[model samples]
Target: MKKNVFYVLMLFFVFTACNREDMQNNPGNIEVVQKDPLTAKEINEKINETIKTKGRFSWKESSDHFIWSTIFQGNKIASIGFGSSFDRNLDSNNKAIEAEILKVIEQYEGKTERILLSSDQYLNQIDVAIEKQETVIALRKMKNIRYLEPADYRYFENEQKLGKSSSGSSGCGFESTALSASDYTTVTPNAKAPWSFTKHNIINAWSYSSGAGVTIGVIDSGVSPEQTLLGSSFNNGLSSGRTISKNGVYVDSIWPWSTGYDGPNDQCGHGTSMASAAAAPRNNQGQPVGVAYNSNLVTYRAASNVVLDGYHEQNGVKIAFTELGNNNNVKIISMSMGHIFSVGKIEDGVKYAYSKGKLIFCAGGTSTSFTNFVGVIFPAWMSETQAITGVKENTSNQKCDVCHSGAEIDFTYQMERASGNSIPVLSYYNGQTDYVGGSSVATASTAGIAALVWSKNPTWTRDQVLNKMRQSATYYPTPNSDYGYGNINVLQAVQ
Candidate 1:
C-alpha cells in the first residue's frame, strides 16, 4: 500500500512539473517519437510482412498492408504530410484531385457497412447508422461503389491504447485533455482581471467590425442548434435541435429522437463547444462571450462516430471539407481535430478550399507534458492551414508547457489550482454551458478571432488575410515554432 501511494505521488510530481508541450527544438513532424523504453523492441523484430499498396487504406485492412509502414522490424512509419506547404496553386488544382479520389473509390464493390468499434453507448458516440449512412451520402449513394471503411484495423491502434483512463474520466477522455483549475480566478460579468487575455483582444478589434456577414464553418461533429446562446443561423437564428434530413436520413441533428439516431449525438460535446467558441451570439449574463458574435455558423458533421478508426474518421472529414469547399457558403473553416496518419486527399482539399478564398485554422495537437509529444499534427501542419497553439493569459511568450506558449506558466496553470477557477474554452454543450481545455479549444478560439479579422478586412485575398494575421502577431517580423508568429492580435491585424 505504501509503495503504491509513493508511485502515485511520484507520477503526480512528474506530470505536474513536466511541461505539456515539451519537444525537441525542431519545427515539425512530431509523430516520430523516441520509442518508449517500455516498448518491446524484440517483439517487433519477428514480422516478415508483405503488403500490396493497392487499397488507399491497406495499412489497416491486413498485416500484409502493415509491411508498407515497416521494413522487417525497426523503422516504423512516422508522420504523414501536413497542408503546410500546400499553396494557392495546389488549392486551384484540388477539385480535379478530389474528383480522382472519388472516381477511385467508385471502382470498389459494395454498399457494405462495416462496424469496428463503438464507444460505451451511455456516452454520446454518434449513431453507427448515421456514420454508415454518411459514407453512402459522401459516395452520393453509389449503389455499386465499394468504399467501405467500417472494420479496417490499423486505424484502431492508437485509439485502443487510450481505451482506458487512469482516473475518473469521461468516455471521450484523454488524461492530457483533463481540465485543471487549481489557481484560476472565477470570471463573471463584474469580474476584474490582473491582466487582459491575449485572445480576448479581438473584442477591442470588434470596434472596427464584429465579424458581420462572415460564415464560419465548423468541420467537426455537428453543432447543437438548440443552444440559443450559440444562435446558429439554421434554426430561426438559434443553434438548436432542428434537424435537417434528406431521403429520410437526418444529416444534421441536434436531437436524436426525431432524427432516428441513438447514442449521445455529440457524445463528447466537443463539436458544440467548438461552434460556440467560434460564434456564440447571445452571450448569456455572467458567461463568456465568443469572439465572433455576429458571424453565422455552418457545421459539417464529419466526426460521426466517436470511437472510429482513422480510415473512417479521415474519410468523413475529407467528405465534409469537400462539401464545405464546393458550396462556398463559409469564409473561414475551423478544424480542431488532428492525428498522425493523414489522408493525402484531405491535404488537397485544404489547399483547394484556401484557393477558393476560405480560411482554414487547425489545432496544433502536440502538448509538452508527454515526453514524446512534439511538433504538430496533420492538416494543421499543412501550409494552407494555420496551425494554432494555446496561449494562456499570463503565460504568453514564455514557451510555457501548454498548447502553444513555452516555459512560462501563467494564469492558465494558476486556474487549475482551485475548482471553478479555470482558463477553459467556454461554449455550448449539447444545449447547455460547458468548458474544455486543450490545444483543440485554442484552435476554436483562434477561429473566432480570425472571423473578427476577416470581417474587418472583407475582400482581402485568402493569402492576404493570412498574411495580415501573421503580420499582426506579437512576434510579427519573426516566427517561432512555439507561438507561430506569436498570438493572434486581432486589433493590430485589422488596423
Candidate 2:
C-alpha cells in the first residue's frame, strides 16, 4: 500500500512541474508574455506557425522596408492588397487560427508597431482569440519608419500658388547660359561644352556620371529621326564622335512602333524633355548641361497611344533589360513613367537592375489628381532612403544639397508658361517638342548626375555612388515634406 502511495505522489509532482513550465512560457496566452514590440523573432514564429497550419506559403523579408512579401498555398494571396494594407485574408486551419489569435493580441494590446506576420498565423491568432473571448485588433498598423504617403505633399500645391519665387528657378541654380553654337571653338566658363566642363572643372573628388560609358536604353513613344537635340545624336554620331551601335541597331529599328520612332521628335514633348534632361549632348557653349552627355543611349518606342491612356510599361521594361543585359556599357537606367495605386512590380524590376550592378533613377510623382492636393507616385517611392536629396539654399544664397529639407525649394526650377497650358522648347524633340516640368524631370536629372559619377570612377559600387552623392549633398534648414534630402549639386559631387 505504501509503495502505491509513493507512486501516486511521483505522478502528482510531474504534473505540477509540467504546469509550472506552461505558466512560465505562457505560449497559449501570448498577451501575458508579449511585453515588447513585435520583433523579427516573434514575426518569424508567427509565420512558421501559419505555414504549418496552411500547408504552404512563400515569404521574404526586406531589411530596407521591413515588410514581408508572402504568397499562400497554391499561389493564393492570403492577404489583401498584396502588401501593407489594412485588409487581409487567412487560411481557416488550426495553426492559422492560432497565429491569427496571437497577431490580434499583439496588435491590440502589445504595441503600436506593425509586425508583418504570415496570413495563416494572423488568421489563426485571431480565431484563437475569438474562441477565448478576447477580441481586440487595431486597424491601423504600420512600421516605425517614415513612409511617403499620398497626403504628404498637399502643402506644396498651396506653396506653389502662394507666388513665392524660389532661387532654384529654371535656368538659374547650377546652370550656365545656353551654349552659342557658332562659338564652339572659343571655350568660355559657360561656353565650354557640358561634358568637358564637368570632366575638367566640376569633377575632382566626386562623379555624377554613373551612366558614363553605359548604354541608357530609352523606351518611349518613339525617338525622332531628324531631330538634332534628343536621340538624333545616336543616329548622326556627332556628339560622342563614335557610331552609336556597331551593328547599326540604333540607326535602324523595325519594331511595330518604328513608324512612330522619331528619335528626337517630342510629339507629346514629354519624352523629349525627359531625354534632354537625361542625356542631351554637351553644348560646347551653353549653360549648365545634362548630367551625362557622353554616355551611350538606346532608344525604343514604348508609348503606344496617349489619348487612350495606354502606355507600354511592361514592354519598356522588357526591352530595356533585354537590350541592356549583355551590353557592358549599360550601367544605369532612368525612368519617368508610373501610376499611383500600383502593386510595386516596377520596383521589383528596379531591384533586378540593381542586383546586376546597374543604377536606376526614377521620378517621384506629380500632382495631377483633381481631388487630393498631395500624393505620391510610383518609381520614386521605390528608391532607397538616401537615393534622392532635395535642393536647398546655402548661407551664401547658393543651392545646397540636403536631405529631408523643405525650406530650400524657393528657387527650384519651373517652366515658364507661354500661353494656355503650352510652352516653348529651348531645344528639340521627336515631335514638335515643347517645354514641360514635373517630379519626373527632377528624377531624370538625378539619373543624369548618376551617369556622370559612373563615368568618373567606373569602379564604384552602386551603394558607394549613392552614399557619395548623399554625403556630398549640402543640407538645407527647416526641412519639410516637399524636398526630401535637399537640392542636387553636381559641382559638389565632383568636388
Per-candidate TM vs. native? Answer: 0.58, 0.47
Residue 298, candidate 2: Cα error in Å is: 2.2
- Top model number, lDDT: 1
lDDT of each: 0.46, 0.38
Please identify model 2 stretches exceeding 4 Å from their true place. Answer: 1-212, 231-238, 242-267, 283-289, 304-311, 318-327, 369-374, 384-434, 476-482
Q: Assess the local accuracy of residue 402 in candidate 2 as a C-alpha lDDT between 0 and 100.
A: 16
lDDT of 2 by residue, 120-213 (tens): 2111111011111111112112221112111111122232344432322211111113333431222323322323223223333223332446
Question: How many pairs of residues collide in model 1?
Answer: 51
lDDT, candidate 1, equals 0.46
Most TM-score-accurate candidate: 1
Candidate 1 weakest ten by summed lDDT: 408-417
Q: In angstroms, give how far residue 108 of model 1 lies from its true place.
A: 14
